[model samples]
Target: MKKFINRIFLLITFTAFAFNINAQIDLDTVKSQKFDTGKMWSFDYPPVEHFKEAYGLETNEEWFEDVRLSALRLPGCTASFVSADGLIMTNHHCARRVLEELSTKEKDLIADGFFAETLEDEIRIPNYYADQLVFIKDVTEEVQAAAETGETADEKAKNKEEKIKELTENLEKETGLRAQVVSLFNGAKFSLYGYKRYDDIRLVFAPEMQIAYFGGDFDNFTYPRYNLDFTLYRAYENGKPVQPEHFFKFTLNGIDPNEPIFTVGNPGSTQRLKTVAQLEYIRDVVYRGYAFVYDTYYNELEKLKTVAPERAEEFEDIRVNIGNAQKVITSIYKGLSDPYLMARKKDFQRKLQEAVWNNPELKEKYGTIWENIEKTQTELRQYGPKIMAYTINRRFTPQYFSIAQKLVDFANELQKPEEERLPDYKGDKLDSTIQSLYPEELDNLIENTKLAVWADFMRMQLGDDDNYIRSLFGNNKGKDAAEYLLKNSIIDDRDKVIELAKEGADAILNSGDPLIVFIKESQEQLKDLREKAEEISNTTEIYDDMLGQVIFKIYGTSIPPDANFTLRISDGKLASFDYNGTKAPLFTTFYGLYDRWYSFNKEYPWSLHEIWTHLPDDFDMSTPLNFISTNDIVGGNSGSAIINKNKEVVGLAFDGNMDSIVGNFIYMPHNNRCVAVDVRAIVHSIDKVYKAKRIADELKAGKIVD
Candidate 1:
């Protein structure tokens, strides 16, 4: 009996030690996940193939022909070639700015649905286009060759950049393509890219905002969602709708409850590569900056809501704005708070180090990459936050100051010789500013603009060393600075400011006032900010640059960055998982809306409208309303084609569950459910709810499935 007890104790000790070791290194030699049975993500159509396997398929010169931009850039964005002439598929919300320009009060296509039933009905959008990757080249050899010759880190980076640009330029002109070289990991490697752009995109179909954004902001990211935020836009060429061969057709039957489906879209950026030190800084400084601004805006929005609850529906847009801002705020806090994310980053970095050490060739060329990482960490900690905090505090200043500065610019231009002035200004640009600031619009801007106040607060707290602001306002105190702004600003009195512009038209411009003074003062900082910002912007260039470098250094081009929105595929499942300690229903119905309504005791927006009282009894809890799926996504992934194993479009990707927002930086395995609008539900809402069958049938979507 004593020996048995001793054996049990020994077993426990061994188990604990093994668990600790696993915790230290989570990666497995073989993925535990079985891609075949649980593979709801990859469709059978093209058959899933690893990049190398696919590359091997290129026999003879056909490989070069097949290796187009669309094929090379993988898992880039949730986009589709909707027409044969390169008409791309993306979200209406994604295309909101373009739609806004095409819309007029008489024809409110965004609020009301817009349909281009025929070719002539399509609306041409100005300066609206889709990005296509045309060429990709790995420039690690050239970059490393130059980097090896440099003494300092900065010199190494500069040398690598120059060599890469020279090499990429030669390759691009040789290929007759627009080429750019992107640098990743300080100066690890470079990626040369060529792009093809489709310029003439047109509006095809869009659901009304009420339908597209149903349940409004309150229901955003929460699952078993019932929103039908979907739109269809077409690409046009020479006044005709282009035919797209690569577009997926809508499937009426949808998919089985746990079928695999895939989505392809441009995921903006992911920080899965950052070292722990960098992430910690983000958690402490950058995230706090976001939270500070978000809190201020949230409070301001609440004030607006309280002041005008009578016109609550009118302020719906403001509420949406607040909700949108809050999601990122919540995500930042959530990411920082999640120790698992920090662990993942640490483990990934450790693996990178291991990979560096394991390869003798890598060590010879890279010369202590981990040491470089350590140095970067040390340098980043020294100056990163003060720099980051200073920038983040001014998130809203550019737009605000730009608008105000434009008014000042107009005043100055009026003072210039007539020939020197812009053609449209007519020495009266202030009139445009005054006319632009309508009461409702101004109120809306104010209601949505808590960031300005936050910025002032941040400046006061952190801007003591801000020589530029100190010089302009003559005081660096945020509060005092704000007060000075109110006193001297041309944006103060809407009417008087306009009148002055009309009176001393040239003097405002010629007076050499502090607006221009401040603007010029900020030039150096602004340039520095722009250059730094591009590093993290998650463009095709940045992605290629970073991932290509990592691959060249570590894995030798085996594992690629997920997708680049060209034609690369991704793998995911249609299975649901637990979240927030509750079993989310496979779907949400209008019954969920009623539940929230009664839960809030007939809240303003959630309460049933007089019209909704007529909803049929069967459209209650039993309705197979909204459902959760385990598809992966990120921003710029909207309007993606959510397809089943049969390669049929079952839904349109609109959003992800709120917990999934962190998928922006790191894709958490369990919570990254891709929230999409079921096609049948959308059709039912249009046909049954709004009685818009003509529009519904025009979409020609497949029949509904239970």
Candidate 2:
């Protein structure tokens, strides 16, 4: 009987493992095969030689400058000057949050799109800006040297920080350009970027969310995408259109078949330089935890949508942000699970190890680096849950919680010396950060709804037995506490909150405001977690910096650095590939889009908006809608201008094929495709569907229109 029981247990375990493998990418291959670094070619490491060899495109400094200057960086996405007179273009999803900010009950921008026939009609989004990259120079040697200026890790880190601050501040003063220093390839290099800021940005055009996002979450990052996914904004200086020195003219004729092209834009971040151990930890722990939390928030936001049906437009950012996070985390989790990706990573690690260990001097300097990283990562994983919990922005919280924390942190920091205060609250950013604490959108209904949801979520995360939660609720579990807090909370009143902002730290902390009190109460509960996370973070940061330098020592500039939301030029071609069983075309058309609509029975997400529902007889359905290419791209590359070597804007890159999701770790060129909205499709919509002919004229400035 005992033998039988043991055998049953063993059988159950085996079955579970099998199921896990089928459900996720097999991790068994993670350490055995050579992986591709996938090109997100940084400007610092210009791939002129590769461009010449692959596409016979010999680019000079002038060409690069034009590429860099034409590009603009949005708050969280990439954009480009599609026309002179400051006409900029980016993805609609990127503009969704800002649109929500400008939206009202009478003018539902999300439901019915908008088109500015003239500059007078353009909507100005408040406090938003677009930055153009004007100059960049390598400062790797200076930064790496700074890291070693002191004996202890703590001292070295401080020295490094001070040096970077000095470098950027001094450069900002000297050049009159906004200076930012980016650490690359872990710590192998640093680059100084100088950007010209454009503060007065006005929205010129945007498609309705239905047509813009199209298939929505179900088809977010997939190919054969029908998403319009475009938004037009114009940069203004002193209430007038600012003419940039360079911008790409639209390619109305669309792509020549199999034409070589380049995607120039800022890619947010990547972990290609991370060690296999780090990847493993992120795969097994970080991604899973993030995905779960994002999923939870996404679900909660969905519920919130149904409750305040009319205010759905106002709360759309929660859906947009949380939805995007879920997809990103889910994609990352799946990529980490991929056996082929892991195998390639493992092979690369083995080679990197062999290369370092073969030379006595190199081995002596870097031999234990990987081991140290692995050990630190193991320690770091111990506090992963706490880190996720403590990050207020990432967690689902009431508006009051985020605003309260910002104010609380700000009031406390105001008392500290300028240099000693937290970096975020010290710079030119402090004023804006404080101003954002009292946004005009914080209404009573939203506040009450958020408080209710937050309370329930807290109960779920912290549990009914938690001291602080119980103290706030007494015998009440869910709805009762939310009601009590909602009725009496002083945080909802913007004037009162601002008044509290003026109060000293002790006064604010001691206040009876439930939200403030809740924050105060969380201090002790989170102290141990914060300390552990900080310690783990500090050690890992130092070691990672050291590791970067060591990798630099070995590889030099042979490999590109990890992406740091800096402008990069990725080269590829108008391409097509096999997916599932069939070949995805290089470009898709309105014909296919109409077919999809019909195939879906003309329902919600797949339903055509009024403009498309009754198509014009003259409108050509064969116009290229979406296309796929082999260019390397990621989340931050959204709204990047895809252009041919002639510098004509052919398309706007908006998404990547499903295989490209693993691109954060590996490049599957054969299968991965960057999805973009063809210029013809964009113009077609503006000219025919939306009847925004004036905006189309801007796009057709130099080129002849049909």
Candidate 3:
């Protein structure tokens, strides 16, 4: 009897695993992958042309011209061309590197607005662009065939990679654009993007970071915003301001409250098509775990900040990271916690699965995909976190990673003979690049951030190593890195953190230090683990497809991905949303600012800097605040064009009402609204506060049209 019971238990376990592999989420049938010819836009309706037609009164053109020149997709950013001359528009957060380059202690361009009146005034960025998408193709069938080659997975992958390069390179030459092929579902579907590259992009204008990032970390997603986070960048060709044939001229007309608007730009990514089961897995496993881990870190960082208020900058820095991390973690958890959402998703998935299983056409479209997904998920669980952690802990540290990168590049060049080396390699270009490495003002910021990280690492890896840590940093055992930072006792006998910045090319090929060794060793580990990763990646891809398949089968293609720096047209009203039992206002005034200021007792980002104080008394009456009529938005939607029903530029989307935090993963339109800065408010602030009426008048003439 006991043997029988044991055998039954084993049988049940085996059956469960088999069922898990076969279980298909039914949510992947909403969107048709086919891109319809003749339609330049992807929204459910034709809002773009209608919007352009609305402007027909101003421009006597027969056809409503296309405002979107091109849309380009990057890993984290979605870029779109607004002007035929290739003026690129994306989120302010998307162009963070450019702003960072322009920042300084005496005049932080981020804190103080930067405006360029002429070409000479335009700040040159190291690498800047309006990446324009010139071409796109559906390579789904070809990639699917390549991936199914009977060769070993590695050989097959290599062959597929080569095929992708060959196809994209040929396309690039044919189209005279930079072409890239992106794999969608473990090679199930492929997207080919052709980008028109523009090298000369100059900063036209950027608002003060204080107003731009008003409310700071605490008030990031919270609504009723008073932030003016917007920037304008101009693209140049042949040193002249190239005129654009197709650009969305800002219109002065207001929006009809219920009219549909289309956002035409590169949208980042969406998981709206995921299976209920997959979402459940993310909610139960990933987000919850992340929240648990970060909750501790968040509290610890906050405590550390409180203990030493002198390290305010350092504290603020970490606080932002912590807050951003927590927002994501909590958002996912909240989405999962809602039974209605879960039920809706589950129902959607089930409907999709049934649709596929019942009909022969559907079965052919999506079958045998579930087994692959489970396998991939299992594999991904093994190394994804470790790989991600490495990038976070190591590659992100500028002092270490930048030097390592330079070393790698230098060694690559050394491999070639001196005669064959690329020209301009050792000229002003190299000097400029090296100069970028030792940005003096950024050093303190970098040091402070690294110090926080190092402290955390010590706490995690070598818990309570008080004596050892004290010996390493001498004075402030847990706080400062002054003693141990390069100049002190030997961690690599390296002093002057700036020295690491200087050793660009030699560190990788020449260094024998443990850090270098560790990096090399990790690369070896990655190489060894490639097969496992590929298998996981492939499965995840399959699962994602299946998830999409299931969702599409249920909900259709109306829903878009979470804001991933991609352009999406969310359809929520401009009204206030309720949080807890209280209603959040449609717009926040200067009173809220004062309330927060007194609340924090005039804190650092919240504390209005000197230039802000002398403003005319009338300016205190909410000059920078505005509301929008768009649907829910998230972090990636910052700097989004918030157009009116007339398709005119009314406001710029920046934040979401805090009451709508759940909108990060799910669009709860009844309670969510995209927060935007009124364009008029921005113009008013510039005219009144900055005393830049000349720039304002020019902007008024061309910035917005009736």
**CA-only RMSD, every prediction:** 8.9, 8.2, 11.9
Q: lDDT for model 3, on a 0 to 1 scale? A: 0.54
lDDT of 2: 0.79
User: How would you encode candidate 1's per-residue C-alpha lDDT over 1-706 as one tens digit per residue?
Assistant: 9999999999999999998986676443322121211111111112324422423222222322221222212123345553234434555566666667888979877666676655567777776666556556667687768765666545655676678678877876687665666543333444676755557767766666654565667777778666656665565667665554345555667567745566655555445445455566666666766666666655565666677777656556655766776786667667767666555555666666667667787656544544544444554444444454344233344243554455555656666787887765654664564455323234434522532464454564356566545544555343455556555655455575555556665555454555444543454465675555443332223223443465445643233343223233444656666767567665666667567667768654454444455765444344444566776666656666666544556676788888777765566556668877666666566566656554455444321111
Query: What TM-score quantifies how close candidate 2 is to the native fold?
Result: 0.78
Give the CA lDDT, 0 to 100, for residue 40 in model 1: 18
The models' CA-based lDDT, in order, is: 0.55, 0.79, 0.54
Rate residue 336 of model 2 by lDDT. 92
Residue range 440-506, candidate 3, lDDT tens digits = 4445444444544554443333235444344444444333554344444222223433354356545
Give the better candidate number (1 or 3) by lDDT: 1
What is candidate 3's CA lDDT for residue 301? 61
